[model samples]
Each structure stands twice: as structure tokens, then as C-alpha cells.
Target: MRAYLATSIGVACTAVLVLPLSLPAGALAASPAAPPSGRDAGVRTGPGAHSAAAAVPGSTESVPLRPLGSTRAPGGIAEQGVAAREVRPFSLVGVVWDDADDELRGTVQVRTRAVGSHVWSDWLEVETHNQEHGADPGTQERDSGTVRGSTAPLWVGDSDGVELRVRAAEEEDETGPVRPLLPRGLRLELVDPGEEPEALPYPPSQNSPETRPGAESGTATGAESGTATGTPVSLGTGVSPASGTMTGELAGPAAMSAEDRASSAANEGLTELGAAEIPALTKAAVAAQQPDVAAKAYAAPRPRIITRKGWGANESLREKRFGYTSTVKAAFVHHSATGNNYTCKQSPSVLRGIYRYHVKSSGWRDIGYNFAVDKCGNIYEGRAGGVAKPVLGAHTLGFNTNTTGIAVLGSYGGTNPPAAATTAVAKLTAWKLGLHGRNPRAKVTLTSGGSGKYGKGARVSLNTISGHRDGFRTDCPGSRLYGKLGTVRTSAARYQGR
Candidate 1:
């Protein structure tokens, strides 16, 4: 008999009411008390107490930025940010403004104090070109009244104190220097990925999926740690020798709401309903599953990937229905731009933080990328749709319709992405692109969905494996990581026997 982790049950039980995305100015007068501020602003520190609102899977605190007066320098610049103050414990931070069409043409920087420390870290800059990575124009996800402009999130680990500043970029003219106007409704977002979900009991069965509750929040080991063989062996379990087909008593549709059932049904054949992850398969096993003989020859082994449940994703946060594209034609690589100061142990927490920020603060339908890879080479499913399907993502602004987005978790502007990370990318694209018969080394034509770099409906030719910059005029995936695309393409092609 085997007991599976009731991750699906966790989703069914943790139902949170969706809140209104934005409020008019008059509503502020009737709102709840403002968040604490100033020197005496010590906030309670705990796992579930971090959210600015009531307990949700994770939490986001959106605080308004106040003006800091003129610099009185040669540039005639103005600044805005919060003074150093204590707040609820948070690990990731980003800035957001009211308008989705607005661009934050300025420099944004932040400094933080570790949860238990008095010292503060040096100011770090947050990338401001995040508009290039989002839902395409005219789509429901993009035109939803809730969408807003945002800066790339920065992971600062667990910090209890924070201070930040946003300065308008300066321009030189005949009369000294002039600064541009900052977008209105500027607010700082502090995100806290909530504690890992607890494992609940399931009826015993020989085929029950394994559970790793403790491993979800910290460094993974054994099966959850991922082995080179790509097969995970289940370890601990409490069981009784009982056997039969899966029943409603074992947590079936009877225990889940209509919405939860819809979400689980999307991944029907990928894993057991409510399973924490989709287990890995050997290359031969993967090829055997493909019906086409030619496709079988090119199919690469499916890599081990953690599911949304495995990472404690609060399923209730996203819109009920999962969205899909016609087919996956290209793969666009990106860097999370969430900084690089995290350990493999903290990857799930970081994911949860980004998830909350994407939906709660930036006002998107869900986490933008289709999948994510960690610095340690671990792969995790992104978005709520099936891993093997062509799930439409709000990643590359104009090319999201027919392409999949894979974001490596960390900044790579100057720092090089580890060899392990790039290898994982190659392995992922080999299996994913091979499914659609795409050749990694070949060029493909993708019509633009309207981006700063390309007009809507423009036929644009791009590599099958492309950097985020290929479709948009932005420094995404970063220079260091972007420079490795040629190597990634060649390696991915080799994996597919090209």
C-alpha cells in the first residue's frame, strides 16, 4: 500500500476569494488602515502573516510611493520611494504603476535588511523594461482592466526592512538637463511565497504517487533532488494493504469543486489527478509513447519537472479556465530578472513570490512563463496548463501565440548562467520542440503581434530557438545568457539527433 501527497486536495481546500484589481482614488479614504511606516514600524514576522491582505497562498503588499522633492541638482530631477522601514517578512520585490500602456522611463533601486539583521545591503537596480515581456495587445489577458506596467522583480532573500527610490531619467537640452515625467500610481510590491502545504493522507494503493512535503520548501534530496537516471524513487509512506481502482474516497471529483476539477483534468494523462509532479521518463520510454516513427527517433527523454502543486502554487489565484495556443512553433528563452542571490533550496519560495507578484501586483492571468529552470538545473512547470501542451503564455509580448516561453530563474546581465542551467534548457527544448517537429537549428517565420520592434501582423523570421530579444527591443535573457544561445541550439539539436 502507498500513500500519495494530497497536493490536489490542498488546492481544493485552499479556496481564496479573488479581490478587485484596482481601486479609484476616492476609495482610499474608506480603505483599511495603511501599512506601518517610519522607525517604529516593526511588523510581525511569520509564514502566513506576510500578506498585506488576508491569508492567501502567498501575499503581496502594494504600498504607494511618495514624492521625495526635487534633487536641486543640474538635472532638475525628482525622486520617489519609501524611507527605510520595517514590514512583514518578504523575499522578492518589484515596482508597479497604474497603466498597462505606461512605460517606467527611469531607474529603480532598492536596499534591504535581512530578517534578523540590523545591517542593510547595498542598493540594487531593478530592470525597467518589463513591458517587453507580457500578454500581446488586444488579448483578454492583456486588455483586462487590471493589467499594469511593472519592473522586473528582484529576489532579496528574506528581508524585514526595505528602502527604495525611483528617479526619472534625465535628458540634456539647450538649457541644462530635463527629467521625464514618471508614471502615476507608482507602488512598491513586496511578495512573500507562503509556507509549503502540509501533506494529507490518501487511501493506500500500490500505484499512488509519492509525496515530498518537506522537500518543497527547502533543498531537495533523493527523488525530489533529481538524479541523473531521470527516474525518481518514492521513499517514505504510511500504508495499509488495501487495493482497488481509485475511488472518490481517495480524493476524486467528489472532494474537489468544479473549478479544481477543471484545473486537474487539464493534466489528466501527465500525472495522477492532484499529483505533486509529473515523474520523469527514460529516453526509450518517451520515444515509445510517440505514435509517429520519425518523431520517436527525435524524441528526447522527458526531464524531471516539479508541478505547480509541488511548489505550493495557490491554484485559486489564477483565472478558472486554462488558455491554449494552436501549436508551439518556437521557443523563446528569458531570464527571470529576479536576481541571483538564492540557493537551490529557496527556488520554490522564489517561484511562489513571482507567482503572487504576477497575478496580484502586475495583474496578469497567471505566472507569465510556460516553464522555469533553476540555477541548479531543476525544471519546474509554469502556468497551470499541461506541461506537454501548447499553453499560451504571456511571455514575449508579440510572439506568445505560437511559441513557448522558458525562463531561467535569475539575472544574467553581467553574471554568466551556470553550465548546468544552460544544459537543462537544451534538454527541455529538445523534448518540447521535438513534439512539434521543430528543428532547433532552423529558422521559422512568426507573425508579429505588435511589439516595439515589430508591427502587428508583420511576418518575422526567427530562429527556432530564440532569445527574448529576438521579438522585442529589450535586453532580456541578458547579454551573458543571450550570448550562449548558439551553444544551446547546437546542443538541443544534438539531443534530437539532428
Candidate 2:
């Protein structure tokens, strides 16, 4: 395949809901309450310690919520004055809520203590708008019928006890609710992220896709994720040499087999310069040197994509390998939900922060979104794998198969996402989705990969360019950015010359 210049690139829970849910007698006490039993907190575990099979590392549990407090944050500041009881050795923890119609009008934070250790890690904020947590959208997880909306998970090494607190944001509508915005149906997750079985080589011997099954939180491990009608699971892109920028495999990290490509090039006795060396030609220069190529350029409004290397993504850090899915059937848009406190120049640092958080802190293989855009609307690649490949993502639950995840960096609740950011969404969708013969404005039906909303194998109709909320029950892409979907679809259509 000739490389096109444009770039790219959970949990389980057995119906734990059926278990007896007891919130304890003290739903609201000014002082902290005693930690409840796993069953009392609505988690359905049998009596006695977990069985050896159940102890298989990285298994998950979904404990239902009761409510922490009715008091609002003093003077409206983010704080973690509350904490949950000791959980199992599941390395990851994320918060989940019930309603998509409502917003999580606050900031949530968590800290965990490693098993057998009393040391407490520093508090870290959980991405709040992540309601779409569960299985991949079109796989057996979705087809098997189990997924849900959840907060981005926090990776705390090996730990048994977890702590969580929400600093309810002051309501924009003072008349809304004098009490802080406490999201409903809160659940804490303890995931094992079981080891993945290897798959066949798509190209050279790259590592097999160790995808998690139902990672709807957009924060996940192998086989434990989804793609969205909007954007399900997502990651950051660090190495993308194919687009004439960055180092590593030309096919992007996911499909890159560096040694093989290098050997083939060496055999031909040609030294390949990086994309930076051979600059993308100017329109006039393109015509002067290669009239045929320039003529083609004028044939359509080409989407100018930024390369991962262009954004200072460090490729050396990613493992030398690639993972791929079959094809991209949909595009899910999301917001990093990491708050807006960055400049365009600081974008690289922001991406790095997210990358480390996902990999080192969250215990994910890599950052989640396939592509990420900045407030300035610059697009960066996410996850491993080629940006062009279906490379499954852990963005949306029960809907990762045959889909792509594109995330805009920053939260967009009350404040609107920059026009530049949403515009990038349109441009990215136009070029990528166009490759698959998808109409950005058209409606498509995706088989439920799995979720709390539907049965296994349920077919779902969704806009080709959808919101994160459309997948599970997330407020991702945020309310303000989500509202701009109509604009995104319209703009994408125009880019595709719809």
C-alpha cells in the first residue's frame, strides 16, 4: 500500500448488579464512615476469600454507589477528603455513574495503597466525563452483552485499598442545585487486565494484539476496550514515521516492522531520508518537480494532518511492535477531560503527561486514544498501531472492533471547546472515514460489542460522526463539545465534498 501523507492515527462484572446492594445506614455523615464489606457495598462476591481462579490477577469488580456526602466543596475547590475501603489486587480503579443526561459537575480524585504496603500514592484526578466504560463495540463482549459507562481508571500498581473523593464544581446555574453536583450510580472498579493470547502476524512478527475485552472507560488494557459512535477507548500517538515525520516504522507504531522495512531498503541500496528531510512540497514546488502529483493534489481538498513526530512525540519510548484491527467502521470523538490549562507550545508536555499517566499510572499498554487534537486543533496520534489501521482502542465499551477513536485535548463542560479543536475533528473524520467509504453525515448500524443498555448482538444505529455519550453513557467529548457534533458532521461532510 502506498502511504498516503495524511496521518493518523474494563472490566468485567458478572451482572454484579444482581448482588444484594446495601448502601449501609449512614449515607450522609459529616464524618467518614466505616468501610463496608464487598457485598454490603453492592459488590457480589461469595463468602470467604477469593478462590485461586478468582485470584487470577487483574479480574474486576463493580461495586454500586450509595453517596458520600451532601455537603458541597468548601468555597468550591477540588479536594479528596473521602476514601473507599480496601479493594482486591486489581491494579486499576475508575468511577462510574448512571445517567448520560446529567453531567458530573465536579472533579474526582483517587489514591491507592499497594497490597501489603501502607504507603499512599499522591492523589490523582480521574477524568470525569467517562461514562462509556465497557466491552468493545462489535466484539463478543458487546455481543455477549456486558458493558457500562465509567470514569477514566487510575492505575495504582498492586493495591488492595482505594480512596476516592469528589469536589463538586459550583453549579453554573446557581438555581440548579444548591447542593454540589453529585453524579449518581457511582461504582468503583478493580480490574485484573488478564494476560492476552497472541494473534497471527498481520505483517512481520509484531506482537499479537493483547486487547482487553470490555474497556469502555476509554482507559483500558488488551481486549478490554471499545470504539464509539463518538469515541470509545483512546490513546496517544508517539511514533509515526510514515507521514514523513518522526522515527520508527513508516506504517506508524502499530503496524511498523522496522528491521524488515530497513532490510528491504538496504537491499535496494537506497538510504531513506526521514519525512523532515524531504519536506512536504509547496503547491508551486510540487508542480515544478512532479506535475502529476501536483495535479492530483488539486483534485480534492486534501486534509493536512500533523504527524506524531511533528508534535515532538518520543518514539524511542514505545515498544518496537504493532497491533492492528481489520477495518474502521466508525469514528468516536472524545475529550481528554484533563482540564484546560495548556498552551499550543505546551501540547507535547500535555501529551507526555497523559501518556505516562495511562501507561505508568493506569497500567495500560500505552496511551488510549488513536489520535488527539489540541485546543489549537493540532492532531497527535494515540495508542500503538497504524493510525490508518482498525487497531482496536479502549475508548468505548463493547464497541472497539472496526472503529477509530479521536480525542480532543481538554475538558469542555461549561466552557466551549475552541472552534479550532472541533474543526480538526471534522478534518480528521473527513480524510480517515473517507478512506473507508463512510459518509460522515450518514447513519450506520453497529452490532453491540456489549453494554448495560443492550443485549448481546443487538444492532445499533448511530451517526458516522457521533459523540462519546452515544456509545455507552459517557459525558465525554464533554457537553459543550458534544453539542458541537452537528457542526462536526456538517464540516466533515463539506471536507468530503458531501
TM-score of each: 0.78, 0.50
The residue-by-residue lDDT of candidate 1 on 345-394, one tens digit each, is 67888888888788777888789998998888778789876777777788
Q: For model 1, what is the alpha-carbon lDDT of residue 459? A: 98
213-282: candidate 2 lDDT, tens digit per residue:
1111213232221111112212112222332112233442334344323211111111121221111112
TM-score, predicted candidate 2 vs. hidden true structure: 0.50
- What are the lDDT scores of the predictions, listed in order? 0.69, 0.48
Q: Which stretches of candidate 2 lie over 4 Å from their true place?
A: 1-302, 312-320
| Candidate 1, RMSD to the unseen true structure | 13.1
Q: After superposition, how far is residue 488 of candidate 2 from its true place, in Å?
A: 1.5
